[model samples]
Target chain A: MENDDTEYPVRYIPASKVLQAKVPFLDVSPNIALKKANNVLEEMAKDYVNWVQEDIKRLESTYQDLCEDPKSKDAITALYRVSYAMKGQGGTFGYDLVTFILNNLCRYLEEREEFNEGQLELIELHIESVRMVITHELTGKGGEMGKQVIMGLKQMINKKG
Target chain B: MSAKMLDLSNINILIIDENANMRIIVKQILRALDAHTTKEASGGAEAFTTLKTFNADIILTTWMMSPINGVEFTKMLRTSSDSPNPMVPVIMLSGHTEARYISEARDSGVTEFMAIPISPKSLYLRIAEVVLRPRQFVQTNDFFGPDRHRHDNEKYRGELRRQEDKEKQQDEMELTDAHNSLLKPD
Candidate 1:
């Protein structure tokens, strides 16, 4: 009989050893640990909120430059980077609305090889939406207002597409 | 296996993501899972450097990053001679769950795929799967990664059903020969 189990040799980390180590972080938290964890995460997310606000300001300034010169690829590139970062960070920080807004922005920017006036306007709207989401600290895909904003943006994006 | 039976305290996890907040969130989840020793890297290059110094039991990385993405990093880990640990299980985290993206990550040797907005339970389940029921590693001329097949079903007929039995036998012989050629000499 052929040895069907013949396989490559690889070092396997034993689960027993891992289970033996002490987890101090978990020990300190009481029941409702996830909520406690969320509180801590919320505190940490505040710092990122400040950073995103600053980045949004930068995006606004860059948008101004693009307005003066549509061919300012640098501004567009900068805009894309800020939006892309926000898209990745929003949901992680419990700001799913920000993630949703930036996700649309990032997808729009990614699809375009170049930015024209109409596309630039769309980008501005997306940026403003992101700014609003962060400014309000809207979490979990904003309530009714968030849905309206997202729907509005989606309509514009689809029309553009 | 239940999560209660699995212990993750001693596990050293390395999380690589371009976004700082994402790294922080993932760390919190790991800590919630009773994982004490965790490391963070902002990008793949930094992760590669960290791997050389800190031996991680498993890796959780994002799919998109500048200069070096998760797929590129996984390829290097699997194929690069200088890799610190080629066989360490890797779980790729991404907001993009498009089929193509998942397929790309899977093809790059990732052991598991996790979508963003991950809950602690989902993350723990993935960890348990990797630690408890790891897939056998496969090595071939063009591939070196975990076997994609996880279940054995006698009723499930694969693509071989399209071919005659005799042709399938011939194909199996050729595959066996190819696999043998990849093995190291004694």
Candidate 2:
């Protein structure tokens, strides 16, 4: 195994010096041509919906197993992986509501030391919120209702902790 | 030259993400930047195989991929004798912004870290940062990757400024000595 003290024979140039000396300005023009990119993203998102629904179903079943056997690390890890993927992809595909819910869910899971009834309920609520987001096609406009759901979930998590 | 004038048409980028949708999003963004020759890998294991033939100029990968995660892949790319180009720059993508995760990616040999929900501007900035202002690679017994420190802006003043300056000067002198020795008539 490699340790921190291992040394190699190379000198590094700092990014700051290179930026100052070589490239002072980074100019990126907004590509007007790619403005229609959103339409393409929407189409791809439509296809992703089916996959995401299937993932949710799997998560729901996993949650049930967790409730039955709370000590199952595999169930928690499986739930986390699916939620983590959704957390990363939802906003990119224009499903910001899903992203919002999943991001919080992932955070909660990360902070979890043990799975309890309260935690399970919160997870269930989060899963249901995701379902609602998908079924309603809640993109960026999940506004008030979405905010309330997130707020309620947060309160529940906080109260339990 | 400004980023606008910089032509990425000649640059070949390899994007490694588990999600097909992510690959599509990244490809579109790179296309907008005028990078036409882009390749995609479903996961890290496939990325290693693709690199054998793709000869990619830069690699953009996600933090979490099945079979082989980004950190493990980066370690292999940096140290494995079989690596096609061990020094090829790597940029890690992820939604997790926690300091621990960022620090982990840095230690694992990633050249850059980009957060998810990436905007065009942010993506362009990261690309420009890597290409225009490349960091020097460091090779340690345990690590072979870009230097961790990135900022050189004059506006910022921190407590470690003087110490960092001294370390940098010492490093430069050592490098000069080594170079001079190489040129000596022995």
Each model's fnat? 0.11, 0.28
Would you list the clashing residue pairs of candidate 1? none
Off by over 4 Å in 2: A1-30, A33-39, A42-51, B1-5, B151-186
Each prediction's total of clashing residue pairs, residues at least 3 apart in sequence or on different chains, is: 0, 2
| DockQ of all predictions against the true structure, Cα-based | 0.13, 0.20
Candidate 2 matches the true fold with a TM-score of: 0.77
Model 2, B23-100: lDDT tens digits are: 787888777666789999998789989998998878999887777899899989988999887777788888877778
Choose the strongest candidate by lDDT. 2
Task: Give the per-residue lDDT digits (tens) of candidate 1, residues A1-161.
Answer: 11233464433222232322432223232224445556666777778778777778877887787777776667666676666666766776778887777777767766765777788878888888887788777778688878887888888877765
Candidate 1 chain A least-lDDT 10 residues: A22-31
| Candidate 2 residue pairs in backbone clash | A6-B141, A27-B3
Structural RMSD, model 2: 9.8
Give the least accurate 10-residue stretch of model 1 chain B, judged by summed lDDT: B170-179
Q: Give the poorly placed runs of model 1, Cα more than 4 Å off.
A: A1-36, A45-48, A58-81, A158-161, B1-5, B152-186
- The count of residue-pair clashes in candidate 1 stands at 0
Query: How accurately is candidate 2 docked according to DockQ?
Result: 0.20
